[model samples]
Target: GFGWPVIEAQASSCPVICSSNGPLPEVAGDGALMAPAEEEEELARLLIQAIHSFSTRSELIERGLANVKRFIPEKITDAYIQLYTKLGS
Candidate 1:
């Protein structure tokens, strides 16, 4: 399954720090800073960076807003429709 929290944060214009596991990378795209799920230190570093650096934060916000568009209701519906059409054929 996809990471809905990542999409929600992106839509909310909040910076994201996510673990590099499962579908998180695909879900986050270029909108988030990711660390290995077991690497607490690295995740902390990314969290600090997101909090302190204005440029990084702004970039995350910008990219997140763009990345979130991929999951819009219309797009998801269209994708499902396409899949079902292909299956039906």
Candidate 2:
């Protein structure tokens, strides 16, 4: 139900390696290298790949930081306001 790991990793300028199952893909977006959830070996491989691939990892960190901004309080409040306005109409 929660995917705080992605945000935490991104905030620290780390590229997240996450499972493809659940809301991980949506949460991690371009910030993560995703592998099938049940595949431990694939997940490990992706993690190693992330570590060895500096350019890709850097891009993921940048994208992750941007994605994390969307969840900030101000953005959340704005979204709430927009939703309320739509619902109130």
Candidate 3:
């Protein structure tokens, strides 16, 4: 699934701490910190970690900005165009 919040957070330069459920871990990748989906305590811990770790927050913002580039509208369109071109060949 396309996780819009992840992208939005990344694009907005916010630190993202997400659950390691579904495509969140895959999509957020290294750009965001994670907690196990079923563990409420783990989620709280990660949130607390993010709040206290200035370097971690900065790292997330940096990586997230880079990750969001792949989802830029023009970039996605380019990928489709490239795929169609390859198929045409």
Identify the candidate with maximal lDDT: 1
Candidate 2 C-alpha error for residue 76, in Å: 0.7
Q: Per-prediction TM-score, please?
A: 0.92, 0.90, 0.90
Q: Candidate 2, residues 1-89: lDDT per residue as tens digits?
A: 76888888888888888889988888787778888889999999988888899888888889989889877899989999999999999
Name the 10 consecutive residues with the lowest summed lDDT in model 1.
1-10
Check candidate 3 and list the clashing pairs.
Answer: none
Candidate 2: 10-residue stretch with minimal lDDT: 1-10
Residue 86 CA error for candidate 2 (Å)?
A: 0.5
Candidate 3, residues 1-89, lDDT tens digits: the string is: 77889989999999999988888887787899887888999989989988999998999999999999888899999999999999999
Model 3 score (lDDT): 0.90
Q: Whose TM-score is higher: candidate 1's or candidate 3's?
A: 1
Which candidate order results from sorting by TM-score in descending order?
1, 2, 3
> Mind sharing the TM-score for model 2?
0.90
Worst ten-residue run, lDDT, model 3?
20-29
Runs of candidate 1 exceeding 4 Å displacement:
none
